[model samples]
Target: MNAILIYLLKVIAIQAVFYLIYTLIFHKSGRHSINRFYLIFTLAIGFLIPFMSIPKFQSYEPYLEVDKPIWYELSDLAEFSNTEAELIPVERINQSDFTTELIVAGISLISLLFLMKLIYSHFELIRLKRQSKEISKNGHRIYCSQIESPFSYFKSIFIPKSLLDSTSFDTIMEHELVHVKKLHSIDRVLMEVILSIFWFNPLLYLFRNRLIETHEFQADAEVIALQQDPIAYQEILFQQINAQKVISSANYFKLNTIKTRIKMMNKNQKLSKWHYLFILPLMVFLIFSFSSREGEEFVAPLKNDVSDVFDYVVNLSDSYTPSIFPLKDAEGVKLTASFGKRIHPILQVERMHEGIDLKTYKGNPVLATADGIVVEAGIINEISWGKIIRISHNGIFETVYAHLSDIEVKSGDKVKRGDIIGKAGTTGESTGPHLHYEVKELNKGFLNPVDFINDFDFKRYTSIEKKDIIKLGKPNQKLKVVIDPGHGGRDQGIVSSNLSESEIALMVANQVFENFKSSDEVEITLTRDKDELLSLKDRVSKSEGADLFISLHMELHEDEEEEMMTAIYNYQSEHSAASQYFGELLSKEFEEINRKFKVGYTEGNYVLKNAMSPAVLYNIGYFSNSESERYLNSEKGMKEIAQELSDAIMASKY
Candidate 1:
C-alpha cells in the first residue's frame, strides 16, 4: 500500500510539471491547434508515466542507491559475501495499520464515485439531445431546447428555445460551430476521464479547466478572425454568461474564466515553430521523473552490540578455504549417483546433475563439507530437501546438504570441515534413505560437489571470487511451485491388496496439477508423472526456481504412528518463514478433513533439505490403519482431498 502511495505521488508530480508548462507557456500562445495537441500529449504522458517502471519496460540505468541484500531470510547474524554497501535497517510504517487501509479504501471509493459521475454526465447529455428538437443549419445538427446555456457537443449545437429568434443567437451559433468543427468535445471527454481516475490530484482539475479555457479562447479567436467587429464578439460572450443554467458536458459559450478568454483574444502571439523545441527538455524531465530510480537512501549498517559467534563466523567465512565430503562415511558410502549429465529419472530428457547423491541409510551422521558459516538451515521443500543446511565458505561458493534426518546446528553456527551438521535420511522425495550434496559457485549455477572435495584431498579447488557472486541473476517471474507425488514406479509404498500408495499419490498429484494448469497465476511442475523411479537428486533439481514445494505421501503406520493426517515442515532454529506459513495452512486443511491433523517437524528430511523454496510433506494418512486406508482408496475421499489441498495452496497467494 505504501508502494501504491509512492507511485501516486510520482504520477501527481509528473502531471503537475506538465500542467505548469502548459499553463505558463502554451495556454495563451494563441495557437489553438498547438495547445489542443499539447494538452492531449500531457494527459497521455501522465497516464503512461505510472506504467513506465514495470519490469519489461524498466530502464537499465543504475539506481543511485544499491539495495543491500535482504539477509533477514538467513540467520540472525548472517553476513552477505558480495553486498556492495552496508545494509541499512529500514523502519517502515506498518502497512497493515487501520489508517493505511482506510486511506486506500477512501481513495478507491472516491475514484469509483468520480467514474460513476462521468458515466452519469454522459447519460445526461444524451437525454438532453433526445428531448430537444433537432435542425441542421450551417453544416451542424442544432438542438433547440429550453436549456439556458447555448453550447456545442460533438457535431451538434444545443441552443436555448428563448434565443431561437434572437439576433445574438447567430453569433453564439457561429462560435458553437467552430467548436464542433474542431472536435473540441473530444478533448473535454479525455480530460474528464483523466480527472476521474486521478481525482485525488487537484492539479489535474486545474489542468482540465485550463485546457477548456484554451478551447473557448481558440473558438472565440476563430469567430473574431472571420468577422470585422471584435467588440461585438466580446459583448456576445458577456451576454451568454448572463444566463443561469450551464452546460456541463459541452463547450458552452458563457462558461468559466471569461476574463482570461478576453485577454487571450487581444493578446494572441505568433510563437515561432522553434518554440516546439522546448518540448525536448519537457520530454527529458518526464522520462527522468517516471523512470529514474533516484533519491534512494543508502543506509549504513546499524551499530549494535556484537556477539563473538557472529564475528567469528564472519571472519572465518571470509578467509576459510572449503573442501570436504559432507557425509561421515564419504569414502565407504556407495556412489548411488554421480554428478554429471544424465537422462532425467522422471522427465526422460538429458540434464546436468550438479550434485552427487550418495546412498546412505537413515540416521547416518552427515558432516559439513567445509569450514564456514551456516547461511540457511531448514526445510526447503518436502519433495526436494527434507531437512537442509547451506554453508557459505565465502561469497564465491555455497554448499548445500539435503534430505537429512536431523540438523544439529543452527544458522550462523561456524563449523570446521567434517563437523556433524546433520544426519542422512530420506525425509523428502526419495525412493529410500540417501544424502544429496551440492556445491554451487555464486552466480555460476552449479558446480560438481565432488570437484571441490574428494577422499584424497578436501581443499582440492582454489578460492572463489566476489565478482562471480555479483553475476548471480534473479528469476524472471514470481511464484513457481513444484509438486511431487511420492512412491512412483515398482516401489509401491504402503500397498495393500487393492490400494497402491504410488497410484493414490499420483491421483492427488495429477488433480492438483490440473487445477494449477488451468490457472496462469503461477508456473507449476511435477517431479514425476507415471509410476517411475524418481531419484532424490532429480526431484530436488526439478524444484529449482520454485517458490514452494508440496510433497504428497502416505505414511505407513508404525506401532507409534497416529491414525490421522499430518504435515511435516523444516525444523531448524532459523527455518524458512514461507515454509512455516505453508505448513500451518496445510495442517489446517488436513484438520478440516478429519479434525485431527498433526503438523510438525522431524529430525530432518533429505529431499527438501536443499530445495530453494519453503516445502512441506503432506501425509494424507497412515496406510497401515484400516480406516485411513479406506479413506485413501475411496474415490470421493480423493476428490475432496484434492480440492481441500488446492485451496490450501492457493491461500498462500492472498
Candidate 2:
C-alpha cells in the first residue's frame, strides 16, 4: 500500500475508536435531535487530514555503503566446534538505499503525526483539568457559569464562586445532568480532535462552534421541557454570564455566540422537515466523497533488455560497410591550429585556446549534441562568457555552446540530439561569426573536439559532438564540501531585462549543489532554500565553516561595447591562495570549454574579500554584446554554462 493510503487507514482507525467510545457512552440516553450532517462532515474531514499532512520522506536520497558483510554463508554442524550450530555472517541491510528510505519515511511520518496529535490533546486536557477545579460544588455535582448556555450533559458546570448563590444552581445542575445523560462531553472531545486535524480549514472551526452551540441548545430545550419557569432560567443565565470559565475541549462560554445560543434556547419552533430532506442527500454525498481514497500507486519498471538492444543494433550496423563520404565545403570550417593551442585571429600569435572553433556564418542553426536539460539562458556580461548555453548529458558529460546570435529556449527546457538551440554569431570578444564548442568528460582533462567531429560532412552536421566522452571518476569517500545557493525570497540582487542576478546565481548554485549531492564526498546546503533576502554579511557568515565558498552572479558591464568573456574573482588576502588556485583551475576549465574566448581571473569581490575559507566568485559570462545577451536568454545556453561551472567546481582539488 502507498504511504498516503496507510496514513488514511490509521486516521480512520483512530476516528473509529473515538466513535466507539462515543456510542458506548451515549447508547442508553437515546438519540437526541442531533444533526447527522455534522457527524458526516466531521468524518469526512478526518479522512482528508492524512493526505493534507505533508509526507516527511520526500527529501531522502539513496546512499550506498561497501565496507561490511556481503552474502550469507551456511554453516555445517559437523564443521562447527560447538555442538549447537552457529550461523555464519549474513548480509546486512543497506539503510541508505532508496527503497529502504521510502519505508522508513512512511513509518516516520505516521509516528510523527500521531505523536503531534497526542501532544496537542495532552496539553489541552491538562489546561481543561486545571480550569475544571475552579467550579463550585452544587449538591453532588459541580456547576460553573455557562456562557455557551443550554449545554447538555451531567458533567459539572463551572460558575464563578461569587455568583453561585445568586443564580439557580439547582436549575443549572438539572441542565448539567441532562448533558451527562446525553454524553455531550464525549461529543465535544471528538469534535475537538476533528478540529485539530483540519486546523488550517476555517470551515472546520465554524462546524466545531456550531456543534457546541447545538449541544447547549439541546440541553436547554430539555430543561424547558420539564415545565420549570423559563423566565427564572433566563434570569439565572444572565446573572451567571460573567462567571464563565474557558473550556479547552469545547469553547462553551464563547462570548460572541452566548446570546445567540440563549435566543436559540428560548425559540420553541423546530427546523422544517423539508429542510432536512434538502440537506440529507447533500450531507450523505459529502460523507462518502470525503472519506473515499483517490490515491494511485506508483511503480517504476526496470529495463532488463537494454544491453541486448544495444548489442543487436551494433551488430546490425557493423554488418554493412558504409561508404566514406567526402566533405564538400571542408575548407570553410577547417581550423588551422589544433584545439588548445592559442592563435590570435588578427595577430596570429599563439594564445591559449580552451575550445575548438567551428567556423560558421551568422544565423547558422546550432543543435544540441545530446539529450539534456538547459540549466542557463542569458547574456554574459563582464562576469561570464557571452551568449553561452550549458547542457548536462548523462553522468558527468556536459557540452557548451557560445557566441550565439539568438537563443531559442529557456532554462529548464529539454532538448534532444540535432535540435536547433540557437544560431552562430560573433557576440562577445569575437573577431567574426562562428560557433565555439566544448565537450567535457567527468574527471578527464579536455580533449580535442575537432578530432571527434572531423568525420562529419561540412554541408550537414549533427549538433552533437559524440567524441567528447565523459570518464567517470572513482568515488571519493573522504572528500566533503557544502554548497550555499545565495539569496532567496525578497532579496533579489541586480536584474537586467527579465533576468535577476540572484535567481541566476541560485540556479547555477543549485546545479552545482545537486552535482555535489549526488557525489559521495560532498554535502550541500543553501543560504536560503526559498526566495528570501539575506544580507551580504549573512551570506558570507553562513559559509564560515564550509571548506569551499562559491558565490554565483552574472556580471554586468559599465561599457556596452565590451565583448563576452568568462572571469573568476577571488579575495586578495593571504588565506586566499587556495581561492586563487581554485580560480585558476576554474578559469582554465572555462577556457577549455569555450576556447574562442578569453578566460581570466581577478581579485577582490566583496563576498570573497574577507579572510576565510577558500572562496571563489565566478562571474559566469559577460553580456555586453547583443549575441551573448540573446544566448543568455536561451535554455540550452544556460544549461551549457551551468554544466561547465559545475564541472569546473567538481574538478577542483582541496
lDDT of every model, 2 decimals: 0.66, 0.50
lDDT of 2 by residue, 1-654 (tens): 233344445455544543443344421122235453345444554554332211122322211111211211101000001001111112234323477558656766765685577567557544644665454454454534323343332264544444456546567666667667777777667666656543534545555555565666666678877846777777666655654434446324323555765676666655444443543464345444333231111111224968533432223111111111111233345331235643233222234455566555687777776555565555744112468776644223456677788888776665665677888777764545667777665336455554334235223211112112221122454333444554556756545566666676666666666666666655666676656777778777766656667766554444354434433334235544455445555655666766323322223445666525666655554455456566666666667766776666566533
lDDT for 331 (candidate 1): 39
For model 2 the local lDDT of residue 278 reads 42
Cα deviation of 341, candidate 1, in Å: 36
- The window of 10 residues in a row where model 1 has the poorest summed lDDT is 75-84
Could you report the Cα RMSD, in angstroms, for every candidate shown?
26.8, 28.2
Q: Which candidate is the best by TM-score?
A: 1
Worst 10 residues of 2 by lDDT: 74-83
As a whole number from 0 to 100, the lDDT of residue 19 in candidate 1 is 83
Instruction: Evaluate residue 125 in candidate 1 and report its C-alpha lDDT on the 0 to 100 scale.
Output: 79
Predicted candidate 1, C-alpha RMSD:
26.8
Q: Where does candidate 2 stray beyond 4 Å?
A: 1-32, 36-139, 143-154, 250-255, 283-465, 468-654
